[model samples]
Target: MYSEEQKMYFSKNLLDWYQTHKRDLPWRRSKNPYYIWISEVMLQQTRVDTVIPYFHRFIDQFPTVEALATAPEENVLKAWEGLGYYSRARNLQSAVREVHERYDGVVPASKEDISALKGVGPYTSGAILSIAYNKPEPAVDGNVMRVLSRYFLIEEDIMKPSTRTIMEKLARELILDGTASDFNQALMELGAMVCTPRSPHCLTCPVMAHCSAREAGMEEALPIKKKAKPPRPELRAVALIEGTGEHAGKWLIRQRPQEGLLARMWELPHVEWATTAWQSDEDNQEALRAALAEQEQIGIQPEDWFMDTEHIFSHIVWKMKVYRAKLGDANRPSTGEEWIPFHYRWVGPEDLQNYAFPNVFVRIMREWQEGNEA
Candidate 1:
């Protein structure tokens, strides 16, 4: 436990440092709760540099709660195509729609009311209330946790919920009379810019003089976070099915089922294989053909292996082998047209922007385009 005077010195010095040293972030320019809400959601599991342009584009497109609420979900997904963790966009829209209808487009000021919104967790609610409404709620995220764990020399695992509760209590106490907005942001800035995860810049930290971890020479290792389980690997075979004749210069793409992982995003036709049963490329091609034909009524003659790529999710890693192919003769109708399922579309390069595709598929298409240009 830190002395009250020590906490006061830390808070005052940190706030003073932040007043002049904080980055000129767009979200900080206004106290608009809606904008703060969007920025908070986008910043989750994302870097500040990456979120900047996305924030500008998103705000320009859906400038208000009503705009985001009424806009088609496809447009939202398309705007969020490359950002990944797309469920954030979906949940944000859902919650915004609720705010538009229930709160007349105004973000809720009370913690309970804001917390009730979908995707608005304790941190988000705290951010919205404090930053936008000047309420003294502690917005404790991973960055804040790192700062607190070091400044106070806390050695508990931050991954545990009980540890988080303690941190939250300490953080709430640190908030001065009316400095919640800048105080929380200061803690975050200190953690990000000075007290980094590795080789913390202790020489430049505003609160380094009294930081308990610095005093003990354990600044870099105080925040004890347990490692998460590694993602399980799964083998997948992807078919880059090219069109023929009048449909030349196009590739077949399909929409994912309306639910589950990467829900409703577009991707190249692919089939999964058990890791233990994985076989050679030729056998994999045969499996891909049989699987597509039996499952989706699509037939293809794989010409050769094109590339190998991998996408890692929280729990799974898809190690994909891509093969170039042409539609099999059976799928060709006598009218010189191809009969694809309704869910599938033959998209040319020009039509790619009209649909939302997962980042992996976007990478594949970009590679194919670059290869053609080369």
Candidate 2:
């Protein structure tokens, strides 16, 4: 248990350190609740450096809550393309739409109202409230957890919900009067810049003199977290269907179903392999053909194997094998045209920007483009 004096010391020193050393991130330049909200959402499961450009581009495109609310879902998804976790984009738009409709284009300042917004979890709500509105809310994210664990020498398993609740209480107590915004940012900044997950720079830490973990030489092991289970692997066969005739310059892509995994994002046509037991390339090719024909009613003539790529999500790993193929003549009618499905489209290289794609599909498109240039 930290004494009130000790807590004050930690809070004071951390804010002083942050004032001098905080990074000049673009999001920090404004007190606009909307920008702060977007930055917080992007920072989840993503790094600061990576979110910078995305932040700039996103804000530029949808400068106001109303713009984001009115923008096409595809455009929003396109803006968030490389930033994985498609649900964040969807939920953000949903929340933005709600803010537009319910809040009159204003970001709610109170915890009660902000928390009710879809996808605005406790941490994010806290971040927006404190950073934008200067509310004394605790933003107890992973960085804050790491800093708190080391400073207080707390050994709680951070994965547990109970531990987070405790941390939140402790965090709230540590906020100096009228410094909630800087104090919370300082806590996370210390964890990010000095009290890192491994071999932390205890010597450079602002709260090092009072850090229980540093004094006890347990800084490296203080924040005890259990390992997560490995992603389950699924074998997927993807068809890189090229176009011919009037659609000669384009490649085929389809929009995902409006619900479930990577919902509404553009991706190559693919089917999961029922079994990874193909005896030969011929068997694989034939299986790919049959699956597409039966499932999508789109016929393809598999020319040759293209490449194999792997994408890992939190729970699933897709081990995909891509096949180079052209629209099979069987799918062309005697009317001398290809029967294009409503959901599928022939997109050329220049047309790639109009749709949002998961990173895996983006990689495939980049690879194809490279081959074209070569």
lDDT per model, in order? Answer: 0.91, 0.90
Candidate 2, residues 239-321: lDDT per residue as tens digits? Answer: 99988777876799999998999998899999898785534667788899999999889899998988999898999999988
**Model 1, stretches more than 4 Å misplaced?**
333-336
Cα lDDT over the full model 1: 0.91
Q: Which candidate gets the maximum lDDT versus the true structure?
A: 1
| Candidate 2 ranges with C-alpha deviation above 4 Å | 276-279
Q: Please provide, for model 1 over 1-374, each residue's C-alpha lDDT reduced to its tens digit, 9 standing for 90 to 100.
A: 67998899989999999998999999999999999999999999889999999999999999999999999998999988878889999999999999999999999999999999999998999999989988999898999999999999899999999999999999999999989999988888998899899998999888888999988989878799999999988889999998888778889999999999988888999999855566888988998999999989988999889999998787888999999999998787888576889999999899988899888987887888889889
